[model samples]
Target: MQDKSKEAAILRSWHKNVEPWTRAVRESEIRSRVAVSDAAIVNAIIAQSPKHVLDLGCGEGWLVRALADLGVTAEGVDAVAGLIDRAQQRGGTFSVMSYEEFAAGAWQQAVDCVVCNFSLLGHQLVEDVLAAIATLINEKGRCVIQTLHPAYSGEPYCDGWREGSWQGFSEDFSDPAPWYFRTLATWLAMFKGCGLQLEELIEPLNAESGSPASIIFVLSGSSRK
Candidate 1:
């Protein structure tokens, strides 16, 4: 078992430097693509009447801001202090803390919905995180998770393959942080084992490249009663 504290520190350092560059890239072309995909997922959950939502691993609290715009009470948590600071500056209620720490505290059983948008991957303790998320959801509550498609996992981080072409590995620039690249089957099985039933799975087409590189999952927990 990796020490959660050590993992958090490493991730924080990685993001502290990378986030500025990422934010710029996001603003250029990535933001619009992410907005389209996230908007779809957020809209679907809003239709279901979400009241209290938790945005886990929320980088800069984009989803939290969006949910607040839609009149939902939302809070975001992330391990990167710089990102959390940026999120706060954007008017998001965010805390700089690891999910493991938060889940072990008073907020464990309090949220109505939990959403992890493209941030839960690369963690060594994914199962533990899923279990923690399950505990956070109220009965019949929902959970949403998104990750890079396994087909895209091994690709070079910088080589944009015209959207659909599967480019083989060129350079592994992924953060040295450990990541689990699971197939769709493995993703489903892990969630099922944690007692959440799959509600929907969406493979998003990259707007610029027109390739499928992201997978979104909507899940519901078993009734607590």
Candidate 2:
């Protein structure tokens, strides 16, 4: 399938599985998340010492809530209305906005940090969105992204589409969307193209397997220290 088609399927899958997704997150059903990735991403963000933060592709606003507890002013945005509704119900600033809309400059608010936690799953639009985010941060800002390590893709070690799955998830979840997998090199290149520099590359380990649970890219504007 085409990149755009796969991207569309991703959004559709999210829209269709909002309930189960929310339940899974709230209950901490995902083992990797419960074991490593969640705190990994959160700690990565806190290390940035951001005054204001934006959680792009923020699902049910869990990160926002977590950051708020630490006294950070954080706002969230997601494309799925159902997810946004659930997020708002829990109380925080969240809007239903697609990455395309964000790339088009829908939200005017700028922040010291921007985060994408396993939410970036597109191609051209992903590049465009990063470009847009580049302009929406302060000079001393950072953009942190945590995603599945490319080395664990179990496919050819190159950039391409891979079938997504709800394999470890409950039976209630369905409509898994195919995601565009990017190698570490591609990820670094994309960041550079967006005028961002890699400040750190973190591989959070999964205790059970002693393997990396996810890879976190800590990036900042070229001028940022």
In each prediction, how many residue pairs overlap at the backbone (N, C-alpha, C within less than 3 A)?
1, 0
lDDT of 2: 0.92
Off by over 4 Å in 1: 1-13, 18-22, 25-35, 152-178, 207-210, 223-225
The estimated TM-scores of all candidates read 0.76, 0.97
**Model 2, poorest ten-residue lDDT window?**
152-161
lDDT of 2 by residue, 51-137 (tens): 899999999999999999999999999999999999999999999899889999998887999999998888889999989888888
Clashes of 2: 0
Root mean square deviation (Cα) for candidate 1: 6.0
- Which 10-residue window in model 1 sums to the lowest lDDT? 161-170
Candidate 1: residue 132 Cα off by (Å): 1.2
Q: What lDDT would each prediction earn against the true structure?
A: 0.68, 0.92
